[model samples]
Structures are given as structure tokens and as C-alpha cells.
Target: MINGILFRQRTGLPWRDLPACSGSWKTVHDRHRRWSADGTWERILRAVQADADTEGRIDWSMVSVDSTTCRAHQHAAGASTRAPKIPGRRRSPARHRSDEALGRSRTRPDHVGGDKAYSSRRNRRHLRRRHIKHTLPEPRDQRANRQRRGSQGGRPTGFDKTIYRRRNEVERTINRFKNFRAVATRFDKRA
Candidate 1:
């Protein structure tokens, strides 16, 4: 039964389409929903993660977190097939002017590679409060402003070019996640 659920998850197949070897599709789907509602799945994960942690198999030092936009699949769009998938691909009087519409087990990471978009002072302060060291590059404008302020500019943010280069690891991970049809389709309308 569990294998049936696993099969569906990996292939992104609808419940009814799950192979018969595992069990009746209805039973597999119902079991999945039941386990989900009862927190059984979360319990299983916690148990596995705990065992792995004790065995020194899991790394807790740093966790990369990032986000990206995924296009809605045609089936997900219902009858609204006329809407342009690409924003601003064509300009028409009737075309909408909108450009685009855009988990947390770990409390914190020992270190983080940050995007320039997250280089705001508030974000930095939050990380500092959590004692998280981040490798975030300052924008040119921010650098110029600090220089313009002279003595009142405070300390320059710590940036390591070597560390910033590793920021792509998170990006690549996100891209890999997009490879899953269930995710790429944004079927649930949420990430």
C-alpha cells in the first residue's frame, strides 16, 4: 500500500491512475489521506531523521532555502486557456496588464549564503539576532551610501566572494525541484 503511494508521488500520477500491484487505487489514496491527517507521515519523518541524526548521517550545519516561480499547467488553468502563460508576451487592449503572479523544521543554520535582494538591514539584524552568519554582498548603491555617510556609515557588511559563489547550490536545488511535474504544475496553487 505504501509503495502505491510512493509510486504516485514520484511519478506525479493521479490517485486513480496508480498501478494495481500496490493495491486498489482507492485504498492507497485513502490510506495516504488518513496518514496525512493523523500526522503519521510527519511521525515517520521525525523518526527517520532522528535516527539519521544519531548516526551522524544528516548534516545540520547549513541548510539552503530559496524560492522560484512555476507555471500553472493547462489542466490547472481550467477553461481559461486564453490567458497568456508568459507575462507580457503579447500586448492587446483586452490583455491583462499584470506581469506575473508570485516549511520550516530547522530553526536556523550555522551559516547562510544570501541573495542581494535579502541584504536589507532588517534582514541582517534578524540573522544577527539568531546568530547566523550570512555571506551577502552589498549592492553598489548601498556601498555608495555608506561611503557617502563617512564615519556614520557604521561597519561594512562582511562578504566572502568564495561563499557567495556557493549561493548557486540553492538555486540548482530549486531547479531540481521544478523537475517534478506535481511541483512544476503548481497543482495545489501553493508551494
Candidate 2:
């Protein structure tokens, strides 16, 4: 059943088109719905991350954050209207306040990298508060605006060209996710 659900997710195939070898599509979907509603997937992911951290398997030297917008299919537009009324399905209290669908790290990494889109003053301030070194290049217009303010413009933001070059890795990772048709097209409408 898990295999069927994963296959469907990977291929973005409709439930009716699921292969018979993986068992009934309805059963697979039902299991997925149940697991999702119960937060089983979240628990599983947390456990895996915990185990990896305990085993010293995660790299903490650098981290990257970025966002990508996916276009939703027309069929995926209506699920938000049918909210599930399941009991005892609230989000965990331990979840980080900063969690926003982007992946999480167990520890603050030594350095962070992102694109110009994430180089806003608020974002930089947030990173500063966290003491996370960031390599986000200011957009030309923003730089010009700051310069227009003279001394009040403050010192230029620190940027490491060498580290910023690695931001391409984040872009490639997003592209890989978009390779999954369901993710790229947002087949699941519920947020």
C-alpha cells in the first residue's frame, strides 16, 4: 500500500490509474489519508532526522533556504473546500515556529545561502537575530535605493561570492522536486 502511494506521488498518476500489482488504489489512498491525518508521516520524518543527527550523519556547515511556486491543476483546486473534520489531528506543539514547508535542520548551520529574492531587510534581520551567517546578494534596485540614502544607508551587507555560487544547488534541488509531476502541478490542493 505504501509503495502504491509513493508510486502515485512520484508519477502524479490518478488513483484510478494505479497499477494492480500494488493492490487496490482505493486501499492505498485510504491508507495515505489515514496516515496523513494522524501525522504518521511527520513522526516518521522526525524520527529519521533524530536518528541521523544522533549518528552524526548530517552536515551542519552550511544550509540553504528558498521557495518555488507550483501551478495547481484545475482538479486540485476544490479540496480546500472539503476540510477534514478528524479529531486529535492538530499539529504538534514542538514544531518550530519558523517551519514553512521548506525542510528543517536539527541545528543552526554555520552558513546559509539564498537568492536575491530572499535578501529583504526583514529576512536579513531575522538571520542576524539567529546569528546565522548568510550569503544573499542585494538586488540592484535595493542597492541603489540604499545608496540614495547616503550614510543612513548603513554599511553594505556582507556577501561571499564563493558561497553564493553554491546557491545553484538549491535551484537544482527544486528542479528535481518539480520532476515529480504531482509536486510540480500541485495535485494535492489542501494546504
For each candidate, give its TM-score against the true structure.
0.68, 0.80
| Span of ten consecutive residues with least summed lDDT in model 2 | 88-97
lDDT of 2: 0.73
Over 4 Å off in model 1, which ranges? 77-108, 188-191
Shift in Å, residue 99, candidate 1: 39
lDDT of 2 by residue, 1-191 (tens): 88898888889989889999999888998888889889988777777776666666766666777777667677765553477422222221111122224354555777888888788999888888999899999999999999999999878988889888876766787777778787677565554
Q: Number of backbone collisions per candidate, in order?
A: 0, 0
Q: What is the C-alpha lDDT of each candidate?
A: 0.64, 0.73
